[model samples]
Target chain A: MGSNDAVRKVHRHPERQRVDRDALYRLLDEELVGHLAMVVGGEPLIVPMAYARVADALLLHGSTGGGFALRAATEGHTVAFSVTALDGIVVARSLFDHSMNYRSAVVYGELETLGPAEEDAALIALSERLLPGRPSEVRANTRKELAATRVVRLPLADAVFKVRDAGPGEAEDDGEDHHVWAGVVPARRGWGAPVVSALTEPDAPLPPSVRRLIEVPG
Target chain B: MGSNDAVRKVHRHPERQRVDRDALYRLLDEELVGHLAMVVGGEPLIVPMAYARVADALLLHGSTGGGFALRAATEGHTVAFSVTALDGIVVARSLFDHSMNYRSAVVYGELETLGPAEEDAALIALSERLLPGRPSEVRANTRKELAATRVVRLPLADAVFKVRDAGPGEAEDDGEDHHVWAGVVPARRGWGAPVVSALTEPDAPLPPSVRRLIEVPG
Candidate 1:
């Protein structure tokens, strides 16, 4: 589909549609998970997936077992991948006007399975994106593990990005009282103190990557 | 579908499947937004929507515009509504096993549009759920506003709930070194301080509902 084709256009609220390519990349880069929807056996199946944006494509990897990603790639079925960040709760004087502040992007396309040669690089990119500054610190993936994983890529060409970042919209003549408190309660995701695993050595220091992740703001 | 039917069962990881009805309700109740997926002209359209779970059904309301929810309801199409809560980020020594702690529920059913008589109560339930303890504080919805809103309900039956709530699972025989620090970094959603709207009266005291929301830990 074309970039601005009617099929991918935002029809519900035309005002919230965003066409900037950078905005779409920023949203994809920031979110850790996405919901993947595809038609399976004539029934729509939506599954939460861990994904990373690599260049112009989204990289998704799953085990070789009954994996949705593997099935979709093998069948060349069209899928819709959506990433949504709920920013806040918009409290309005009227219930009808109350809403949520959010940024969402939905991409539609068929996923292509990566070949064995490219799978290793894609896996490294996914790891680096999910756990920044750690790919070098950890041991490389073994061939057995790599063979059991399925990696797929979906391009970001046909996508729609919509954002509602402002506070509640209230009209002057809505008839609701003006004295009521109305605004936005921002919702944010933050990382708590990391808990060391049970099998870790007693004196193992916190990795620099984990430390940096804690220092960074979401 | 039966509670544990093959279609509703969590095939990939049967261990994470939660069969309790109360667990499904709790997950839906805690989450404020859900991804609604419906097939439109043979293409899957997934939209993040503000939703509230009442008793045995989810209440969703949208404007009379080209809203997907309204279209799905009007056409009596089958839709899948999914709610996911990311509890924590799992930091594992093995890139292959890295995962996120989360609770997700997907309900598959045809949406039923509520009649005018039931729309009012559904809207109130939605408002109360989103901004708890606020419906009584604000004025009731005006007739004009209610007339322009479309509400639909989807039952909680035929739903699947999956949860992953533990630290990273590691095998003793695994080749990865045990010296690395690996565990979970809890991810949580919290409300920031409320910012009063521009049209609100100056020095309008924070509503009790807003105050309560701030006090409650997410």
Candidate 2:
């Protein structure tokens, strides 16, 4: 969480930089999908994967991440994971100053693959993050299934959290006409009605977790 | 758009791989921010950048992406960019089959700094993509501002696209309780009303582009 290093520098918009652990945790908790970035074959590669923030570490589903993230972990290479929530759009007086309202977090660390016990817990944690309060409603993972799933852990020690949530910052002395309106167009995300698939029983009741999911917005 | 390259493989979910140009084009055109991944100081780094698809190339705003992207362009290093639209979450009968419905794209290529004319056009294209018709509403960037902006271009080649759009795909004979209701929870993103800043004139009218953005959902 120190700021003296080159990796943590927010050079362009230093004012937007945040070093608190809460910022990073909130960002990871809010987004279920993160772009897991790694060096593959001497070139950069990225795969969008389902992830979870368990306490202070990140658990990545290697199968969903294309299995290369697991390989990177075994190879002892440092990987970077990034998540973002585009809050809104800032319409400025000029195109140069036009920007986006967003909260972005990038975590960099060497990954460690979890063993059987931790893997089961990590996969359940990932599922809970993706669909909260749903683990108790379904069956547990079989032994083969647990072995098939690859979960890697990355400590939350190194990360950068940046947020921009404000109105336009147009200079007062700028020569643009104030009559040209400028402000923000906020973004909102919500969950729609639960769609029952054909395989489900016609009279089967929806789980309590799903009812909560429909009622809440995340 | 060929799929014979190493970077274009979608191993785990081979059935979800898409080779059509429409799929790739639509994914790029829809999202404004992408995770730009590159190797910095022997470690993986990912930055969420505002990007636009112009013709057959991706134009990244270097200033918004941070100065390192421009430096990476000049250094002749390759980078990867990824974008995702989480359409919904599939609540399957079991935890193993539970997954997210998403459209993800990853583009791998080296970057090139744009010339003056191309930079101006690319900048306009970036803004136009982010806020559809708003480019025409705002004033042009000043000469000094143009000089300060670093716009890099990457051809839309050697990319991979994967999509999962169907409902829960639980097998008929998988031997789970039929009474466990399962389905999909759709995700929706919409723009709220614009908040006029204090600096704007009281009677200033909202631009048509802003109105169009609110009326149409992307």
Candidate 3:
């Protein structure tokens, strides 16, 4: 999938572009914040981070501070990460086709910097792709906290994804007024009850990796 | 709050940066999706948009198709626009302190482009900030759908606003194992159950602006 000239199709919905590499690893394994962009000083920054997807790359950790993912892994430059997710809102009865049922992706390369034994297996594959059965329930990284953390991998071979998840295209001689309540409102993203930390142990029990992330589901 | 040299403080927690103006209008009125970025040909593209926040600016609309927000509103360049939200995931106990309780902002300037009489009041303040009371319950834009849409805007004076809503910053002889389950997993973002439109009228009802967005409160 990394080949129709690898990424760059979808000049604004080129049929919701998706050169499927399993829909770019299912929108980089169901998004958890991404945005990274680059070119600092000559402006364009972006930021947001927190990423994961460890196998074909895309790791990104920080705190060796002076960050922009540690200066795009010490100036190898050329960045651009993205991710997105927002899957559902598209109410369309026209506010110029009110849309938003996203999935996004983006990628673009150059970021490597891992070493120190591949940043402790890219921080335990970014804590098992952000806490899925919690990297064997915590407690491991210590070489002085993996030499004060920095990670940075980025390589889903120049990605692109774009989905939209249907519903609301409205156009049967589209003259508006179909009694409007037009479909889709979805936009979910759950996991609420788990505020614990007063420094834990006030009956220390909710940890089957945080009760399987609030019984998973959203 | 556009001056401590206005917007360039958080280089990675320069103390959760935020130069206030009502915390950049409550993270651009509780975000809906932003990203945007620029520099097209020499790389860095980004995209995702769907923005809103009317008054001090930040609007963005598209469809005149040669995309990247109509080429960053026709090459008046300097783009950026971010917006994040994420609000919770912090499951720390170290995976190098697993973070993410975001609120982001970003903004860096130059987008203007709005005239079709201020693109119909920035598309009714982006359809009343994305369907909140569904732009007085639908049906309005028609001057050939406001001459095929494009909008733009951007200003909130070079914004910044980086928040990280606490819970999980542990340190007390920091050696791990204080009985696991470290806090925060919140990440809410609601609004589901609305499906309605197959062309509406299957006994058409659910409206009070989609029943006040499923009783709001996320």
Candidate 4:
């Protein structure tokens, strides 16, 4: 085992602050999906979902027929939500001390069902959040489509934000002479080459949302 | 919400299947690092850890002095174990319907205390698993380091495997005509450029085990 495998409070770096409320919201808004875990019938169920931000709440949408979705809506059980992005691997002199630099958010809250108008707005917000201005470019949801969907909004108050950034901790014996290449190998995420749909008409121009996002910096 | 957002039983493709128990063991073995969650003092505690496999069981090592670790060892609480690899971003046509392609295992089992010899074997197995062949190259653990570590093993029978593979699913009517770019964005995991430890002598070569896995074939 690596020497630093301990999960004690001391190992939990305090310097990795939880920024603030707005920063937290920004992080949530920027991400397209999250993992939702809840205790249902005394057993834990974890499911992946795409989510949107509604004021100080997170909005999760699913089919009206999904077992978890129906149960969560009808019973109003509290749920745990988590979003994680692995940024880099931290290799230390001792194998046991190796670590991962990551950003994660964990939240617990009861979900509130949204009415028709609220649901539509939440869906649009989610689309826009995921692809910046993409919602305006794509065809809007039809009334029939809206009738078959379900949306749940959960307040963000009961969440815990945990993050680890910066380089790996330096060992007490770390020095110039130690000769350990002690520095971060940065990881970056961005779009790769886009593939046009096979059936897309030759006349249909590339959507502005995709073009704009590609131009913007992450 | 996109039309494919309804209840669907995701299929497991052949290439994604584990052909042998050895493959499952390798998956468990390769990911020596994990996050273990269980109830401690009536509240949930998530502990990051290094684990080893012995026969059909998984051994988790912790500091004998740690709170949750000690409490868990003495109380023998039931714990949930999960190991996940985020393989790719699966972009389906629908915003609410999009999903991630991932591999994850969830296990629920009671923890057990490991005997001295079992503990030693577990550590060696874990080290060799993390960096295959490292156990032979590096010096064996000292008696002091062994005495300071606490190892607990959790068995396999009570586990369920869930996975999502293949490309994203589209709604019945949201056919190939939608013109949206839809497919998976692949993610790769392997050793990055190795950083030689500053403490190592100038001409020291990377051990064979480390070199072997540096660029593992897909």
- Model 2 scores a TM of 0.94
Among all windows of 10 consecutive residues in model 3 chain B, the one with the lowest summed lDDT is: B1-10
User: Order the candidates by TM-score, highest first — what do you get?
Assistant: 2, 1, 4, 3
Residue-level lDDT tens digits of model 4 in A84-203 = 565555544443444455666666656777789877788788667666666665567778767767778878876556566554455543242234333333334455434443444566
Query: By DockQ thresholds, what CAPRI class is model 1?
Result: medium
The model with the greater TM-score, 1 or 4, is 1
Instruction: Show the colliding residue pairs in model 4.
Output: A2-A96, A3-A96, A178-B198, A178-B199, A179-B198, A180-B198
User: Among the candidates, what TM-score does chain A have in each?
Assistant: 0.92, 0.92, 0.40, 0.83
What is the i-RMS of every prediction? 3.2, 2.7, 12.2, 7.1
Output the number of the DockQ-best candidate: 2
What's the distance in Å from true for residue B75, model 1? Answer: 2.7
lDDT of 3 by residue, A1-218 (tens): 22223225665668877788877787788777788776655556676777688668788775212364466435766777888887778787767777778878888787878778888988887777777777777777889878767777888887777778877888632667677668888877777888887777777677787787778766
DockQ of predicted model 2: 0.63
For each candidate in turn, the TM-score is: 0.93, 0.94, 0.35, 0.69
Tens digits of per-residue lDDT, candidate 1, A41-160, equal 555667777788988999876521127435743576678889988888889988878888888898988888788999988888888877797788777888987997788888987887
TM-score of chain B of each: 0.92, 0.92, 0.40, 0.81
Worst 10 residues of 1 chain B by lDDT: B1-10
List native contact recovery per candidate, as a fraction of 1.
Answer: 0.66, 0.76, 0.69, 0.06
Error of 2 at A147 (Å): 1.3
Residue-level lDDT tens digits of model 2 in A1-218 = 22224754777788787887887788788887888887776677788988899988898885344675567555777788888989889988888778899999888887887878788888789889989988889999888778667888888888778888887887642788899989999987878889998888999998998899878754
Candidate 2 CAPRI assessment class? medium
Clashing pairs in 3: none
Worst lDDT run of 10 residues, candidate 2 chain B, spans B1-10
